[model samples]
Target: MNSFLLALRASPLRWLLVPLVALDLTLILTRDGYWHGLWGDTGAAGQVPTLFLGVFAAAAAAWTSSLRRPSEVAETLGAMPRPGPQAELPRIAVVLCVFLVPYLVGQAVCFAVTASSWPPGFNQYLGYLLLGVASLLTATGLGWIIGRLLSSRWGAAAGALGWLLIVMAFDNDLSVVNGPARMQPDLLEISLRAAAALLLLVACLWLPYGPRITRVSPLPGLTVVLALVATAAAVGNPVIDERHGSRTKACVKGPTEICLWPEEEKYKPMAQDVLARAENLPPVLAKPDAVHSLGLVYTEDRRWGGDFDMDSGSVWAMADGLTMAISAETFAACREKDFKGFEAQLKADDQSVLALERWLEKRLAGGGEPEYREEGMTESMAKAVETGKEMADRPEAEQKAWATATVRNVLGKYCDR
Candidate 1:
């Protein structure tokens, strides 16, 4: 116990904590207010500090290992009663303490702050947090192993490079956190990655150093390490999980039935408020029918609901999403109509629908005429934009007439058949 205390005094972690905490808090607080009150994102924010700290942890671990080689320590022990892991693992624990303590503190503070506003549940997805922890352990262990192997000052730089390479290798696969999306982490991918990291850390723990640490053959361990690396390559992409939501938790609000997901339940009042203000706008294209949450799909009609995100809490975002949802409904209905083989992509690139969307957005959000960018304007798209601007410039009756007739005709033409 006293040895641990003594080690802490000598460790650079004593000084690193202040800067690390400052950096970590900055990451947590600097972003959009949308995520600050949310549970999952805030918990994920807990892992943000380690992305930078992991490299430092690796380099520092390697540097410290070079300073205290187990063989040299064994020599110093001479004929002492106990020699191996008892003498060594504790110091490694000290190294882990240096890096992990700040991580833990940052996590606790983030959660505490988020918990005040989000009452129903905690961060349901812990895979990202676990991923962060495993990465930290892997970096520290790998760095220590590198220094042990090199037993030189250059070990620190090598350790940093190795850690960076590992991060890049898993770069596409690492889906640590997202803002307000309904999609959660892929547990299968997360487990596979977390497992691979653990196995490697186990290999590091069992690694035999010279003649002092272990008498086991290095060949068997090397083979095992190779196997683990190959398995890591097989883990699936983490961030590629689908955008999903539970209809069971869906809540319908306001006159148009804007359904939102469970996490978005808190915004129901605000959504209703926004819908009320936009009442002067034309009736929704898919009026009287439901406008489900962004991810809730109706397979029978192949209707992928509406545009929704955490940003819907903002007044402008809510108005924009409501108009987008109505426009999407029009798009979905048009897809059901038949088009010629050559016009198949028409369903995707329909200009009339874009115009309708922009026009409705202008009315609901109270914007000026829709700006058509000449840079990439196709002839048909320019005509569609012109129609939308004309609609926006018209009076309420003309706007409604345009919405029901012009959009209907356009949908019936190419956007439809």
Candidate 2:
């Protein structure tokens, strides 16, 4: 314990520890996903902070490991029977302990803050987090090995920058925690990486000591072979399962239901309100019965199945969902004719429904067309928005009458044909 404290105070790493922790915490909390309340997204986003953490750890380990003394070998032999460094052991321990505290704290904030918001589901990925910690530990081991071999500060600088470039530019599973993760982590793959890191660290422990071999060593060759296997698996094999179909949904149950991804519970009330307004359509026209978010599993039922952008809480996004819901009702109730390859009539029927949806969207905005989100807005949709603006001056009853007549016209033109 005293050796640990002495090494910490004496090492140059002492200057970096405070800054590293401050910067790490800052990065974690300030990321776009911190307030998202997404269990999977938050878990996946953790890699951002871990990137710097690993780089710093590797650089620090190399910086200290390269420092040598003439009596160090003799002192190591006199101090303990252990094969690893005595003073250097304390240095490694102190470096790891300092960086680990901030990493763990940042992770805890992610879970605790997300849990506070009542996310759709809690997918505890302790294994992925473990893989993150192990990544840093492995980098530290490499730094020491690199420093020991090269014995220069340039090696430490290169190791740090090289680690960053590998993580950002390279798409290796061993280094990347899956960019913008789909939320489903392959536990088996995570475990394999962790096991490989542990093996690498074990080898690192043996590198600075042991009797200089008079003959060629087979152990180094064996380690190289195992690393090749890990590499192929990391690159050639898929390490993550699909994010969809992995979790259940949080539904706003009603005759006109709205179901969103479990992580998007915060938007449920707004989704409910959006669907509820659609329920008030004229009795002559079709109304949606159920609406499911885009993130949910796929279904063939047009009336019951669709996805949404409720994750962003944009009102226009809700309008888009409303458009999908009501359009499904329009198709199912009024029906469509094959036209026997008559593309012109088919296209006209589609335009008629789109016009109805656009006008209905204006109604959903409480009788005035506010600036609707233009993201995914189409040429037909823009025309529909203009149609809504043209009709905005008329009474609500006139608008309802037009919507009802349009549906009836579709039913007559297509259903009767």
Candidate 3:
């Protein structure tokens, strides 16, 4: 323990101070960025501790590098002729502690702070700590092993790149969090990956020196554990296929545990309903005669943002009233033979109208699906409204007349009114 601490203290802790300070500054400045628009937000401070991890990795890499050529301690140990396999245990234990304990503590602190405002019995923050520990250990271990393989210089650079990629993968919104779909990995997978990386590191450290081994093979043990754990995870994965698209590589990778965005058409019915109801819905959902402006309800609150998912409590709270109203409008428009006006309405309200248009154009250029059905707005009227939105602008009077005519046609044909 003394030796390990000495090693850590002896190193250039001063160099890491810059990044640690910078990370803290960034966290303080970006407090609002981490919010999910919920009761208790994580705020950017939640990620502040991770900065220590980066500094630790960099420091550990440099420290581990010095061990390559025998040190004064190694020389003294060599002189002890009959050194047992257990003799090196202290240093190894110290290494493990240095790599793991402090990071875990930091993560725990972050988790506790974030989880405080959450509902009682929710230990997600603890889970995050465990996750963070697993992550850092894995990364540091990999860096250690790589430093052992290619000179420490190249290893540090590689480790940094790997860390960046991992962060990018996590921030990607398209990936699913908990599912049996493709294109994303789960927390379990991430831990497994980390474990695998640690094993690889230990193996790299001990395996190269011929048969007179000072260490028990880490690979065999890790492999067995990983195989069993992975099999169990795959067997017990609960996300249904319908909720996720065909399983993709992202689903299996560590940290990305879910598939990318669900197949677009799966939610078509729900989307149609929202559009249909929204069109004819009175501004005030509680009262029938109130003319609620669509912009005020959807835009002001950012109800259409990709944030509030179907299963979320927020979505549930707003759905019955909001979705119902949106659905009515879309349905009413579709029923009215005013296809043009219907399209225009869709264009006006669709959260992803521009994106869809761009996507459509790209798809057409690439010979992909040109006629895409939106899962967010499902009713026939919503679909028509979406179509109108795709067209160039028409005169306001013409648009209004067309909308009225379409409504009459819908009433006469579909409602038999």
- Per-model TM against the reference: 0.74, 0.70, 0.47
Q: What digit string (tens of lDDT, one per residue) describes model 3 on residues 223-331? A: 5345435433432342112222233211112111111122222323333333333343222222222222111123334441221133222212123333333335435
Ranking by lDDT: 1, 2, 3
State which candidate, 1 or 3, has the greater lDDT: 1
Quote the RMSD, in angstroms, for model 3.
13.1
Model 1: per-residue lDDT, tens digit, 268-305? 77667656655765543764355555676544556544
Comparison by TM-score, 1 against 3, better one: 1
* Candidate 1 Cα lDDT to native: 0.63
Q: Can you write out model 2's per-residue Cα lDDT over 323-393, one digit (the tens) per residue?
A: 76776666563443444323543566356666776676665555544544556767766676577556645
lDDT of 3 at 416: 44
lDDT of 2: 0.62
TM-score for candidate 1: 0.74
Candidate 3 colliding pairs, count: 47
> Which candidate tops TM-score?
1
